[model samples]
Structures are given as structure tokens and as C-alpha cells.
Target: MENRGAKPENVEIGLGKESFGVTNLQDHNIHTEPELGLDIMRHSAAHLLAAAVLELWPDAKFGIGPTIRDGFYYDFDLSFSLTPDLLEQIEKKMKELQKQRLPYEQSEVPIDEAIALMEEAGQSYKTELLHDLKTKGTTAVVKGLDDPNVFKTGMETVTLYRLGNFVDLCRGPHMEHSAQTGFFKLTSVSGAYWRGDEKNKQLQRIYGTSFETKADLKEYLARKEEAKKRDHRCLGEELKIFTFSEEIGAGLPLWLPNGTIIRHELEKLAMEEERKDGYQRVATPHLTKADLYYRSGHLPYYREDMYEPINIEGQEYFLKPMNCPHHHHIYSAEPRSYRDLPVRLAEYGTVYRFEQSGSLNGILRTRGFVQNDAHIYCTEDQAKDEFLRVMQLHERFYRLFGIKNFYMRLSLPDMDRLNKFVDDSESWTKALKIIKAAMEESGLPYVEAAGEAAFYGPKVDFQIESVMGTEYTMSTNQLDFLAAKRFNLEYVGSDGQKHPVYVIHRAPLGSHERFIAFLLEHYAGKMPVWLAPEQVSIIPIAERNYEYAKKIHDLLFSADVPTAFGGVRVQVNHSNESMQKRIRAATMKKIPYMLVVGDREQESGSVSVRTRSGVDLKSMPVEAFLERITKELKTRQDLPVE
Candidate 1:
């Protein structure tokens, strides 16, 4: 250990530093590579930020600062509030320190001594963490929401990284010096609860991002600005699609009339597709007896996400978190044979969950949402084919929506975390093999992750990126070997013996709420002709054109002959507002078409069409316009009206 000057008790003024030599760096592989080093640099930037904050406000206390998806955030329990001005000041201080090229000196101290050092410095949170590490091991500290990799179990000493005058408890693979953190910009600040619990103190979190090059940082900032403009919460309100009320509660979205229309179009498409795929739609009650969940193993494994049970008629009922249990009961209601195997049960089921308020984001993460869910109970022999069929169905839908940048993530269980999954190792192995075979047979790109599987089995989550490059899990498909045994779902085999059926749970569209949110951002609220709530809006140039506009509206409305895409919703704007104002209103609503009727148009029996994209499809006969739009609707293509 190199003693820079400070004593061991305080570990300040850069003293008693442990050696992180070339051998240790090689063994641990501290990130010094290209793109792989971005996270390490960002994490080091977080420490630099903390050191700057302490320089400005010596009394400030900080919690853990971790690297999130594209950035890093540090939480501070400060006596004063942080603002944009303060962020700039902190950035200036960080630059001053960076110019010095201060080395990230390392030190290791006994757990008790570390606690004493934190206590002397008045960092109660750090003290608490050190005590937790000493008493319950690193696993227990991880359960308290700290990073699991930050400490090792049964270790008597903890590593601390010192950046100048500031010291932090961390098991680090950070950049060598402050200058190596690359170009960074402080983005924003928000309030966050310590350990993600609402009961804990609310700490002000400062968010920022780092990039390897100035051009990369500039490009990221540009994309971030575009993302802000395309934020779903803002667009949802501007489009009048959805709203939330305090009385209705958080994460429970209230869809407006226009939003309902959009949902109807999506549901119509789903029904048509499922019908062609030979799926039998089933409906189940929103509430079910708690015993059913226990039998399905959801009560024990997913209790935290589920709502509390409701007692009625001396029986406990739970708002169903999923429809699999109900569908199982339906399958067992009638006896089945091998010939009757491979029952595909589909449902647009509305399920309820008690999502944490902090995690809720617009309609994306909601308490009440309807899933485009289905279950295929098939024999082992037919399992691969059925799974491939589901994958094909997903591909078909994605192709229709022009969603090309999506991939599957195979989530497998970690034996170390066996408590989170079922104890049936044999079943787990078989299910994993089946899913792997089906995925490989599809010849699609996929990545595997450990400890992310479902409680009963392994699953493939379809991760999709929006136009702004933000990725999320849009759909999921799981192969379950335990559900059959748990629910006693069986089919008689060719040998006249009852055999447990293999179950595949899939949700291609995920939920209307989340999918709609994605669509709002993906399309920038300019929905395609087929999915637009008001497909056409007729605006009269003057009062004389009113009659002609009404005639055009009626014609288009009636021409919406019952099809799977449903009716082409058309409206006639007869309000006293100016024609341009009406046109602007329709444009703001993202209506696919604006048909302008004037004396010349009326006399010629034509309508002047203007698209939401500012394309003027000059005068055309009403019949010709309808024919063109009808074809677009039928095809369900995002053919922007030109």
C-alpha cells in the first residue's frame, strides 16, 4: 500500500493507497478497451461528480451512484436543493479537477474501521452500509439495493476509491484518472427514494452521461433532444389520447374516445390474425380465488407484484395477474385426447398488478392493462412446430408494422438463485432445450441471459427499439413444463394413458397500453391511415361547401363496409371556425386525410385532398379517393398519404 499522506482512520488527503498493479488489472480486466470501456468511464465520472459536489458542499451526503442504461446518476441528501445553475457550477469544478489528472487511488480497510471512518465523516448512509456488510454478508447488503458486485461475501475488508479529497466505498474497475472519463454532460436532476423504497428519504439524483469522443457526445445529445420531443406523455396529452386522474390512481390509464378507437383497430387486427392462425378466443373473469394462484405457484413467487386478496363470501379472491391459471381450468373442464392436443387458447385478457408507483411511466408500465395473451398446450412432439408458428405470427405482425430492429432474448434461470424458480431441475432442462431448439430453428439472432427466466420455466423476450433507439421488451414467449403438473393439465396419449401437456405462454403485442405508448413515440403521434382514430376529416372552404362536405363525409362513412380493419372513421367539420382553423385542428389531431370542398370541387364532383404530412393530393373524384384509402386500410400498411 502507498501512503500518499493521510492517516488510515480518515483515509483522506490521498493516503495509504492500495496497489492496483498491472497484474491485478489483467486478472480483473479493468475496462481499458474501446466501446466496452464506456460503462467504466461513466462510473468513474460519477465518482468525479461526487468529489466535485463535496468540494462545493462539504456537508453533502451521497448514496450509491450506479451506471444505468446510457448514463449514470448519483443520489445526494443535501441541505440545499440542486438546480440547473448548480449543475453548471458542479461541472466547472469537475473540469478543474479533471485538468489536474488526479489518480483514482485505491485503499482497503477492515469493515469495522470503514464504519468508524464513515461515522467520523457524518456519512450515516455509508456507515449503515458498512455495518450491513459486516453483519449479514454481501448478499444481504445486495438485498438492501446496493450493487452485488461491489462487495464479496465473507470478506473482512472493503475497498475504497479515493479521488482527491473525496473517498467512496466501492469495489472498482474504474478509469485510472479523472481525465480518462472522456467527454460528459450533466443532463438532469430528479428526486429518488433511497434503496427505491418510498418509505426512505427522498434524495436528489443528478443524471449525466459520458462518451468516448466529443462527436459521440454531441450525437447522443441530439438524439436525446429528439426523444424529448417524442416523449409519449407529452404527445398523449397533445393528441388527447389518454389521461390519468388522482382519483383513478397512478398507473391506471383512462383512454379517451380517440384512444379507444385506436385500440379497436389494433384489436380488430389481432382478431383477424388469430382467426387465421386457428386460435380459439376465450374470456375469463377479472377476479379468481386465491387458491388458484397458489396452485399456479404465482402466490409464492409473484406475490410482490400482485394485489392483496379480497375476501368475499368467506373466500379470498385476487385480481388475476395473468390468465394462464384460468385457461388451464378451461382446458381441464373437458377431457382431452392426443387428437385433441395442441389447444391454442387466445385472449385479450385484462389483468391487474400492484406495480410500484416509482416504476410507473405513462401507459408503458401500468396497474391495469389488457394483454394480447395466448397459451398453446401441446404434446412434446408438437411443441417445436407450435412454438415456431407463434414466432412466425410475431414476425408477420412485426413486418406489417415495419418493425425490423427487434431481437429475442433467451432468459434462463441461475442455479445459484434456485429459490426464485421452481425446484424441478429436470423440467427446467427439458424446457430450456425445447425453447433453444425452436429459437435456433427460426434462424434468428438472440442473446441468452442468466437469472431472468420465469418462475416456472425459461422465456424468450422480444426486445424492440423505438425510432429514437430506446429499447424495451415488447413481447414475450415462455415454455412451461411445470404448469401442466401444477394445474394437473393432462391429455390422454395414444397408449390410453394420461400424460402431462407442455404449455407455451406467449404475448405478441404485450398490452394495448404499452404498445400504444410505443406507437405514440414511434410514429411521433402521426398514426398511419389504418390506425388513425379519425381517418378522414372533411373541411368546407365556405358555407356553400358545407353541404358538399357533409355529402363527402356521409359517403366515406357509409363506404366503410364491415371489414377486419373496421370502419373508416370520418367526420365533417361544420363548426363556425375558419376553414384553415378547422384544417389545422384536424392536422393537430393527426387525422390521415383532410378533404377540402369548395364551389369548384362541388361542381366538378371532386374533393381536394391534403394529407397530415403536408402532401396535397390535388383534386380527385370522391370515388377515386375512397378507393385509394380503402386499399391502404385493407393492406394495413403505413402508406403515408401522398
Candidate 2:
């Protein structure tokens, strides 16, 4: 750890669930290798930031300062408004503190003393936190606090971290002194509700990131700049993929023709794959009786995410938050026998959730989204096989999307919270064993996470890393022994007895909205031929070539190319624009291929083609070019360029 330079933000101590504790780096064997090391430095930098902010504003009320994928943010309620100038000033203060070599001294003080000190410092938030700690009986293992996950351990303690004159109530595994945090910059600031509740006062959140070396920070910023250029929200507008309107309502995306075409293609691909896997297509109503959710045990556990019930006549109903409950009802709708034991049902179900407004991020986090959801009801003996099949489906989707960096996060139930989890000891043990065995056999890299599982069963969440190394938890599958038991879904086994069936819930693509966003960033909006809204844009070099361009467009429209909006997306630039300008416009739209027609090409019965990357393919006969692209589009080839 010293070789990596200085102390880690926190140490992983033993907890019934996932937890970390603050301690000197020398106390335990800490591995700050690469990614983990970067995270530690960034989190530690957050402490440095709070310290800096404290110097600027003596009345600043501190909030959580957790590290995100690429940066960290700390919320502070201050007397004066924050500005770009203020951020630069804070950075200077941080640098001064860094030079002072203030050790991140961790101490455990009596709850009374801690509260008094916080009150004296005029930090109501810290005082309130201390009061909560007192009520919760601050009995942590009494060590350094570092990781943000440490807070969730539910331990009440006053771990005071003092650096120079600025002190904060935190879990310290910060740096031995401030300088070890390395190079850091204050990126930006935004209004964040204290504790993330809208009703709470809005606190200004200062965001920043840190790296061990200036070069590393430069490289990270370059990738970040690249990511901004490929951001789906921007590309979506430029390519006319999707749009939003205040009149249409928030988070409800209005898909244009191009976006609709791409969506249908993705849906077509998933449908065909599931069909080959013997999944029967099924559809459920957008709304369902509230009793159905109660029966499936979603009413209490999932109530917060779900919208308040709609009063349909005298009974209350709900827009479905998930498709599994409806599928469970479907399973119980008919009498099942052993021969029909392993029934696979699939749907491209659209579900709704009352997501917090601040948490929404383009299509990635939306109020309404479509899920590639499916459920399988099978005997206990068949559970592993079905789960493995689901994993394979997930792998296939990742391959199709050209996502190579990914692993499974096996979310296991927290044993201590039996009430939150199903209280079936035998079932829990058997289900977990089955999931683990299947994962081990799959030969995929995976890690187990305690307390991340659905209340019903353990889940396998697929975490995908984009080309830029940003990770997203985009897909998942979970075994459901509890839902089956709750819904009383059973099958007539060969033993001539009605036995409760095991259920497997799987979503390979997650949601079209979110998946498309991932694809946009993954491909940088240059989707492959199959997924591109406009597969080809036909451009006429002059007015003489218009007739030939239309003919080529007709040929494509007649072929297997997708049709949306009106007819096929065989865009013909009929406007009197320069050839270069037209070509550039087509390239900007990210059309997979552009067909350039001129007098010579028309006379030769050929078309010159250029890929979205502007590489010329010279001239080829119209038939030959059609054959090449149609085959590529139909097969959904993972192309080298877009």
C-alpha cells in the first residue's frame, strides 16, 4: 500500500453485509491497485474539499461526499452563493492545506462531546447526525471511516477527522496527511437537495476528481471530453433519434422516425433470439389491480418506487412497476401439469416508476421505459438450466452491442434481515446454492455483493463497461422462490402432487431507453448498419443524377431495409446543395453508408459509397452494393466502423 503511496480512504472490515472501516493504511493489508487506488484517492480528495470549503465558509453545513464513477461530490449549505471564482479560490485553499500536511486524524469521542463540538462549530447538520448516532447507540468497531458504504453499515459513531482547523464528522481512512491525495480539480457545482429530498433545503454540491499524477488526470479529462461528445442526449438530437417536450411531459421520450426504426430493429433481434430459446411471447395490460401486487409481495417492498394507485371506479389500480407479478398471475391463470413445467414467457413490457426528478438522466433514468422482460416457471431440477440460458442470452446481447468489458455482480440476500428477505431458510439456502453453482459453471468472472439482492431471491446483475471504461448495471436476472410461494403458482409433478414452481426473472437488454443510451455512447452514435435509423443516404452529384439516385432509393426501399416514419429511410438530397455540403450533412446524421450518384456512375449503373467515417468505397454496381449492405443489415453484422 505504501508503494502505491500513502493510506487508503478506508479498510474493509468484517460485517454481516458489505462494509468498510477507517484505519491507517499500515494497519491492514490494503491493495490500492489501479482502479481501486483511483477510487480511494478520489474519495480522500472529497475530505480535502470539505476541509477547503470549511476555510472559505465557517458556517458551511457538510453532507455526504461520495465518489461516483469518475468524480466525487460534497453537499454544503453555505451562506453565500457559489461561483466559478469561488471554486478556484477553494482549490487554492485545498492546495494550501495539502502543503500543511494535515494528518487525517481519526478519533472516537463521547456522543455528548461530539454533539457539543458540532453545535459550537454551528454545523446543525453534523449536530443532527450526532443526535441520530446517539439514538442509534454509536457502537461501531471504532476505527477509521473511509468508504461511503461504511455509512450504510448503520453503525452510529462520532469518528472525528481533524485536518488543520477544519474538522468533519466522517469515517476517516483519508490520507495520512492531505498532500497524498494527489492532483485534484474542482470540476463544477450544482444545486442538490440536502439528503436528496426535494422538501429538504437545497445545498450546493461541489463536484471534483483526483488522480495520483497530473498526467493521469489529463488522460481522464480527455476521455471525459470524448464522452461528452458522444453523450446520447446530444447525439440523439443531432441524429433526430429522439426528442423531449415539456408539453409531452418529463421523462416521456418522443421517438422520431429514425429512433423508432432503431428501436424496432432491436426489438426484432431480441424477439427472434427469445423465439429460438423457446420463449412464448405474451402481453399484459399496462394497469393491474392493486391486489395483484399485494399477492406478489411487491406492495410493501416496492411501494415507494410504484406510483400511488389509480382509482378505477371503487377499486385501486396501478401502472405496473414490473412485469413479473403479471406473469405470475398468468402462470396461475391455468392449471399446469408436469409436462408444461418449464414454461418460458417473454414480453417487451413498458413499465412506469415515480423516479425522483433529480436522479433522472436522459433516457438512462426515466419515468417510463420498456423492458425486455421475461419469466420462467420450472421445477427445482430445471432452475439451474433456465438460469444458465438467461446468462447466455445476456452474453449474446453484450456481444451484439460490442461490449467486451463486463462481469456479473451476484447480489446475495442479507442474512440478518430475514424479514426483508423471505424467511424460508431451506429455500434461501437451496436457491443460493443453485445460483452459485450455475455461476461457477458459466466460467464468467463475478463477485458476490451482500444485501443487494431482491427480497425474493439472489440476482445476477450484468455490469458493462463502455469503451471509455464507465460501468453501467444495465441488465439482470433473479431467481424467485418467494414470488412463486406468494402467488401459489404450482405444477402437477410426476409424483402426482402439486408442488410450488421456481421462477426466474430475466432482462437481457434491460430497457430500450437505457440500452439505446448505452449503445449511443458505446458506438458514439455511429450505430452499425442494422441498428442505424437511416442505413444509407442517397446523394445526387447534380440535377442530372436525381433520376438515378431515386432509382437506387427505390431499390433499397424494396429490399429488406427497415421502413419507418413514411417509407424506407432512403434519404435523397434533392435540395440544390453542394455535393460536399450534402455529403457532410449525411455524414453528420451518422448514416451507415452514403450513396453518391453522378453522370458517369449512372451511365455505368454503379454508385460510389462512403462509410459514416468518410472512407470512400469507390464505385460498385448498384446490385452489388445492395447485396453487401442488405446482407450486413439483415445479419446485423458488428461492423468495424459505426
Clashes of 2: 5
User: What TM-score, computed on C-alpha atoms, does each candidate reach?
Assistant: 0.80, 0.77
lDDT of 2 by residue, 1-642 (tens): 111111111111111222111112222221223477777778778989998988887767887788876678899998888999999999999999899888888898876888889899888877877776676443233442553444534344467888777787776566688888899989899999766568989999999989888998898788878988988899888888889999988888999987888888888888889998999999999999988777765565557667988998999999988888788778889999989969999999988887787667778777889988888999999999888888888888888777898788786666776454345757877888999988988888898776555445666767777786666667767787876667789999899899999988888887888888878888999888778787788989989888999999898787765333333457788788888988888888888788999998999999998987888988999988887876676667844542
TM-score between candidate 2 and the true structure: 0.77
Worst lDDT run of 10 residues, candidate 1, spans: 7-16
Q: What is the C-alpha lDDT profile of model 1 across 333-402, one tens digit per residue?
A: 9999999978989999998877688768888778889988888999999888888888888888888877
lDDT at position 628, candidate 2 = 81
Clashes of each: 0, 5
Runs in model 1 with CA error above 4 Å? 1-36, 47-68, 73-97, 100-174, 191-205, 412-433, 450-457, 492-497, 561-566, 640-642
